[model samples]
Target: MGEVAKIKKFLAEARYHHQEATSVDMVNVMKQYKGLVSNLEPYVFNDGTCRKLTNLSGTIPVRYKGNTYNIPVRLWLMDTHPYNSPICYVAPTADMCIKVSKFVDHNGKVYLPYLHEWDASKANLLGLVQVMITVFGEQPPVYTKSKAPYPTQQAMPTASPPYPVYPGAATPYPAMPSQAMPQPGGFPPYPSMASETPYPPAYPPASSGYPPPQQTPYPPMQPSPMASGYPPQAGVGAGGGTITEEHIRASLLSAVEDKLRRRLREQFSQGTAELETLRRTNLELVQGKSKLEGLVGRLDKDCAELDKAIATLEEKEAELEKGLGKLSSEEPIDIDEAVTTTAPLYRQLLNAFAEESAIEDVIYYLGEALRRGRIDLDAFLKQVRALSRKQFMLRALMNRCRQKAGLAG
Candidate 1:
């Protein structure tokens, strides 16, 4: 998978994320650390809160002395990343030993000014990496382990020293490796143990840019027989013996083992990347399922409401059909007779009320006509006043009739 894709997947699969800003910052940060391998790993905090957080593990180039060396390191992004600083550590290999210094502790945890003064707005992984490279150059975090055998404590005759010792010195000691001296500008050069001797080369630096660079795995350093704790060969042995079949077999087996180990390491890394991708896919599937379930629930609710509305419409349609049939069966009636009141007194009141209603409609129409310029304003006023007087007289008569007929006005 692509580096960006891998970084996104790592964030998505992480057990906990404090905020969106953290994820956004992580994307940009991961781009800078393209050489590092990103994955979600469980981390236990001081308070015993175990959480799976995104981590970038691998080596970054540190220029020490006059050569560049890949320093193995790991960075863990906190749940509240960008806002909080990431935890960093020196990851030494089996053949190497950790060198405790001001920047690195006995436990391999890194400490630096940049990390201590981390700013959410300005501080980033790239800056932190640069700081690490500079600090590690001054004081290398790790060194190759010595494989020389220990001498017996048996008392023996003391021989003259091959190398002259200084005054007050009990025994001669090997010269200390020269410390890296910074140049006028740029980073300090790195020291290489394999440079002087025929030891294998360390891992190379990973490329980084807008277009993600590929990670080229460096060949693992092969162990020299002298340092590998292997028995002396041929004339080198105490008894000056020739090369044997057993020795050849052992040598061949070691070479095969190294090849197998390198292959297995590559395969393991590939499997891990694929597994993370699968986890991301699974998470997406689960989210999609939840959305589909919610949509289906809403659809079911809408269907139930529609069913009720359909039933009410059906009832209304039946009532309308029944009324239509009754009207069809009835004979045609005179409009005036059809509207007649039950009693004579009520009939008189109804006629007066009808006249008052008619006058109100006439007055309204006259006002509308005046507004639309259909009648003059003076004629509209005179006609409205007359209609109003008639309407008042008709309303008074209707009230009296209603009282006599014992009906509500």
Candidate 2:
């Protein structure tokens, strides 16, 4: 049978068993069936068939008084067997098992859990017994076919039969023509093979085919001065009808010379002004220097006069010093000695008059004798002493004679 037919048959069996089985019995049965199918070919069930079992009606699994259990439910399969399709199991509470309405994604394939709604009244008494027996029976071991089932191709009809045909026997039914197998609903259309059709040729490879148009080998161009028709040589001029190259060059030179001349004139004027200023400065310096020189000359003359005055004063001082020294060295003369040495006969006469004269006369004669230098100072002093002694003895004798003479009288 095809994969879809096999899935439909499994759903039918699950529905019949669900009506008779208790929730525990139903879970056990499902577990056994799951084990039995675990190794079956994956293509045996389509995703749509699984979804129908998950959303089955009426009987469902439920929790009563804190204990959980599965209740019998019914389902309709619309696609595989539209009429009188067997009812399948569902959970009383959608949360009891994974919702069949939800798909199971294993790798890229989708699997769905079983589901059912609950109904208390109707019972499948016989079906329940049969379901329990079926669940208890030893499960069939999982089997895998060694090779894939190949699709059979129908044989074509031949025009002639192998034996002669009876004339009136029911005409043998002509062998039916073989029809192409229907494609799987989910798979896409087959792609066309690439080898049959050719690709349009690529745009022809860029042409190097013709030798590039023969490049004319140009003659060596001669170098020309810009002054000539070509661009003016380094120091040349632009061409014009009336203006020759020489004229343009001359004009340029004249402009340059004019600029140089103006610069030179400016420099000369500056130099002249600087020179005039220096001349004035030089004149002032010369006048100042001359005045200084005259002051120096007058100072020299004053210095000379001072020197001469100092010399004359020194000469006069030296003469005065000599005279004072000579005066200090000279001795005073003795006037008496001088007179004695000069007088000759006056000495004896003065002495005789001094001895026989009266007192006044004697004083006069002594003075005369001193003036004549006749008296020796030493002899005169001795005479003066003898006279004093004589006068004293004469006084004593006169006193003695007076006493004696009176007695005698």
Candidate 3:
């Protein structure tokens, strides 16, 4: 599956509180941040409840000392996302150490003004990550142990306490103006790397692949005398029996076999992990394919139903059109003489109902005129009362006539 498809699947399985909104936000973020990978991972909240949540884990670029470094970061989206902020952490590798500062705590949890003042209308994953990159550029969250001279125990900076620092607590890693400034004897620089010169550089370049490949050293081996074009010589043993060339040959062969076995085992382990990852990817693709097929089938069924409905509507339209043509061909009849009642009593009842309906329209217009100041309040009230009394009499007459004519009232 593609990245967007994978992200949709992950969010779907996790059962987010706001699925549609969260999916849109995450899809945009994933597109902008192609390096980041989305997955469903278990997240433990402060209340100790663990839930599987969508996680975006990857590295972001931060420039320091004119060089760019890919800073690893992990974001845990809350189930009620868009409304809630994501939990962000600076994930340091084994060789890297967390540099606690105003933005990052000892536990690698990130704190930022944007996150503190999160407005769902304006704030989003893309903006949150941008703020992190900018803040980290000024004060890096993590530094490689090989590049920075970060001692196990160092004096705290005296300037001001960083976040996670209690209200009245002492500042963590406080440094004096002289120390913060890279003087002759003061700290090397604000960051203070292990090296005085930036040769190998801290972390890998931003362009390097994620989770950079490990450089495994070749197994050490002591060369055998046979390589020198000289056969092993027999030597006198401490016990009195002479050491033979065959013994030396056998020892060298055993050493070579052991090294080969270890190398093969390492390769096998790495291959197995890669195979399992491929298997998971294949399963996800299969599921996506099944879902798409089902959707297509539903769409086809709906289309067929729509076609049947259209045909029914067309038939009804044709019948109405034919009837309209017949009426057009005939002469127009006076509405009053269109139908005559069988008895005079029924005729009187119909006329009374018509007069009563006319009175209702008159009263409605009077009210509208009153509302618009077209008539005075006294006149409006007087006219409404008179019309209402006439309407009531007409209705009574209709009821009496209906009874005499044996018609339903």
Specify the poorest-scoring 10-residue window by lDDT in model 1: 205-214
Residues 291-370, candidate 1: write the lDDT tens digits. Answer: 99999999999999999999999999999999999999999888988897778888888888788888989988898999
Which scores better on TM-score, 1 or 2?
A: 1
Off by over 4 Å in 1: 15-34, 149-409
Give lDDT: candidate 1, residue 196. Answer: 25
Model 2, TM vs. native: 0.23
Candidate 2 vs candidate 3: the lDDT winner is 3
Error of 1 at 371 (Å): 29
Q: Which 10-residue window in model 2 sums to the lowest lDDT?
A: 200-209
lDDT of 1 at 408: 69
Per-residue alpha-carbon lDDT of candidate 3 for residues 204-320, written as tens digits (9 for 90 to 100): 321111221212222222333433444344563323322234434444465456446555654554456456546655887899999999999999999999999999999999999
Over 4 Å off, model 3:
146-409
lDDT per model, in order?
0.65, 0.36, 0.68
Per-residue lDDT of 359 in model 3: 97
